[model samples]
Target chain A: MSEFLGLYPYWVVIFLMMTGFYIVISRGNLIKKVIGLNIFQSSVFLLYISIGKVSGATAPITAEGFEVYGNPLPSVLILTAIVVGVATTSVALALVVRIREAYNTIEEDEIKDEIRTQGAGP
Target chain B: MTPSTDLLTALILTLLVGTAVAVVRMRGLFPALMLMGIFSLLGASWMLVLDAPDVAFTEAAVGAGVSTILGLTALALTARRAKTSSRKPWPALVIVTITGAALVYGMSDAPGVGDPAAPASKYPVPSYVERTDHDIHIPNVVTAVLASYRGFDTLGETVVIFTAGIAVLALIGGVAVSVRNTGPAGGRAGDGQGGDQPDELARGVEPAA
Candidate 1:
């Protein structure tokens, strides 16, 4: 079990990704769907951090007293990803707000109905 | 040497199977989303075990962070519940099964896990370790791979971000204006519901009037 605990992170991330993907693809409520997306993205972060871990190494800094250092590359990549993630989230939220204003309902089918109605005469 | 290794292996196996089943079985979008987060967390740990921190981090951020958020955003504009259609999702299942089987079969030709003499360590890694002092000062191989080997690709990604930002500004008519209390014509109905929705959302789910 202990050994399994160590690898628990990897499988967890994969599970989260798949689950989140399913939610995003299948869900009806817009906000709930976003929550699922967040979960999926967070799993990737876990995967990255797990990769960076070293058995007995220290932080990746090379300060004067530093001897052993774990990997720093993962952290760097994650930082970039975080920035991009935040940007994408804000943009998505903005779109959602626009969608609400245009359709008055967040439901996908409802919006589709509205569009269809608009497309048809009167 | 210890039974702990066996236990760890079992636990991981169980989690892998459980996560897959849960993801497959989940009908609602919310719970499924949460489960996805769990899956990513597991995948991150798996990367760690493989001693591929850089890859793990990328997966965590891009896969779990950005992808999840983007997906949820799209979902937010749609519906919350899932409806199972009469059409079976058989094609996707078949593809996934075949790919998985093929990957497992291909693993037979790969080096054993943690093998010191693996080509990965022996070939490019050793050269990087030796020549890094002269070529690039960065000690991290992943950094070298990204900033040096794939520098052009990184630049292209930056340009994509810039383009997306500009596109949003132009299409959405610039920054969001403050929601006014005034109604559509000059009065109450629009003032009550119109301003309130955006405000409530901004306030983090306070009930809208």
Candidate 2:
């Protein structure tokens, strides 16, 4: 039970990561794939934050009589990661829109089929 | 970790896992997007439980808020339902299982949650936490470390976001312009001899003239 308590968070992280990976690989919809990627990234953020935690620490605010503080480095790093994740999501969605406009379908297989047919000509 | 905090984290993790599975199983794109928002919100809550309020704040704002709106906008521009995949998922399942096993194996070596002696807390982090009072004097060590020590990385991250925004604007903006140009002009031209020309180009049936 103690060991389980110690490592359960990491197990959750792994579960989330694999779920996202499965979605990214199995889904045909471009948007669904993007959503999967977002889940995967968020899980990574959770992993980092989990590592930075200190049991008795509150927020990383330096105050009188407070000895333990969670590591601020991971939080700071993850702030940048969160912004990057947003930017990447927006860019990916924009590309999906453009793909839909060009091919009229966002299905991965259909897009591939269309490309093959177009390349082979009438 | 205290029993209460541990229980809370476990509950949130269970919800997060359930949401992720639901997201993968759902067929409708809109509902999946909503689930994705809920997933982010739950993730933010978990972060809060882990004592990283700053991370929780950003995750709530950016992950749940901005990403969901962007997803809705993209869905409006695309199909509502994901085409059912015909391919066998066994290969993906095998791969995911292997990856999960490897990660689990790796986790055995990782330090427990909030372990003070963990390598992550050893070197520069302690220095940052110790000196924040004397050097930066900011109450929030996160803000001080982010703004003072890692300012360059944050600046680069901002520039990357700016560039991505510009790229999205260029792509989506160009599509909107082409759409508008083709709509009215193609309608007008369709009434004339050149009607077939713009209509064909607008539909991407032919190369633009």
Candidate 3:
């Protein structure tokens, strides 16, 4: 039905958000968790861009024939977000590397076990 | 929306969702990382469809480009395959379902996609479209708004990125990482193992502050 189709974008965004959230919570792999974070961050970007859409409008470059343009504010905000997401991901990966050097494993449970054993030391 | 645009958006969204699920289930870290990059590309495409070329350009460069490279580099330094998790998925699955249902239901009040009457279209008095020409005289309104109107936010982002670079350098860039295991008289048993890290990562630069 047209009604259902009208909300398809919302449904998809939610599905992506939940999937990413689930991966972050349930998965033990640190790298996977980072990937999940990226997914989750991306869904937020999509939501912003989705809201900025204006039907039948061209890209926000002013031209002679075009009468309307999609919201540039959202595009601008999402641009900052995309850059920040990359920065966050790289920092996370760097931490994962350091964690691997120290703990010798990226698995959450294994890292916990390492901490426990190390805690017993002097 | 035209039929072609609708079709493109639908197709890209389907691919994006499918890729996200694949990343969740995949045990091999490499393939999962690849899928994540693909998801970014697909999302960028959809941004294009939504008439956000500026956003799509940035996402394609930073999201699909830099993130993938950094992920691959980190993958090289760490474990390649993920160990099977010992935890049950039931709790996560239940939480995701409940939250998703609530979010979907709540969206009923949101303006339909691309509705011209949406608040976003009207507000921000002296809209950028009108001001870009009269005031800034820029052909690309997105740039005018992002650079001139919102210059401070962009400047702040630059600072944040600079800070992130310093963090990366401290964590893995130089001698700070290797120095932890430098002297034989270093900390107890577990510390010595770091000395044998890969040749490229091995460096004798001064210890990080």
* Total backbone collisions for each predicted model: 53, 0, 0
* Best-first order by DockQ: 2, 3, 1
- Candidate models: Cα lDDT each: 0.53, 0.87, 0.84
Q: Give the docking tier of candidate 2.
A: high
What DockQ does every candidate get?
0.16, 0.81, 0.76
Q: Model 3: per-residue lDDT, tens digit, A1-122? A: 67767978988998999999999999999999999999999999999899999999898898888888888889989888888878888899999988877776789998888778788412
Better of 2 and 3 by lDDT: 2
Model 2: per-residue lDDT, tens digit, B1-209?
Answer: 88998889889999999999999999888899999999999999999988899989999999999999999988766767887989899999999999999999888888899888888888787788888889987788899978888889989998999999899998899887776676776767777875555463345422211
How well does chain B match by TM-score in each candidate?
0.67, 0.84, 0.82
Write model 1 residue lDDT over A1-122, tens digit each, in one string. 45444444454455555555555555554554555565566556655555555444444433346444455555556655655665565566556656655665565666667778798422
Which residue pairs collide in model 3, if any?
A: none
User: What share of the reference contacts survives in each candidate?
Assistant: 0.08, 0.92, 0.88
State the displacement of the C-alpha of residue B197, model 1, in Å, after optimal TM-score superposition: 12
Candidate 1 residue A60 Cα shift, in angstroms, is 10
Find the 10 residues in a row with the least total lDDT in model 2 chain B: B200-209
| TM-score of candidate 2 to 2 decimals | 0.89
TM-score of each: 0.55, 0.89, 0.88
Work out candidate 2's RMSD over C-alphas.
5.0
Q: Tell me which of candidates 2 and 3 scores higher on TM-score.
A: 2
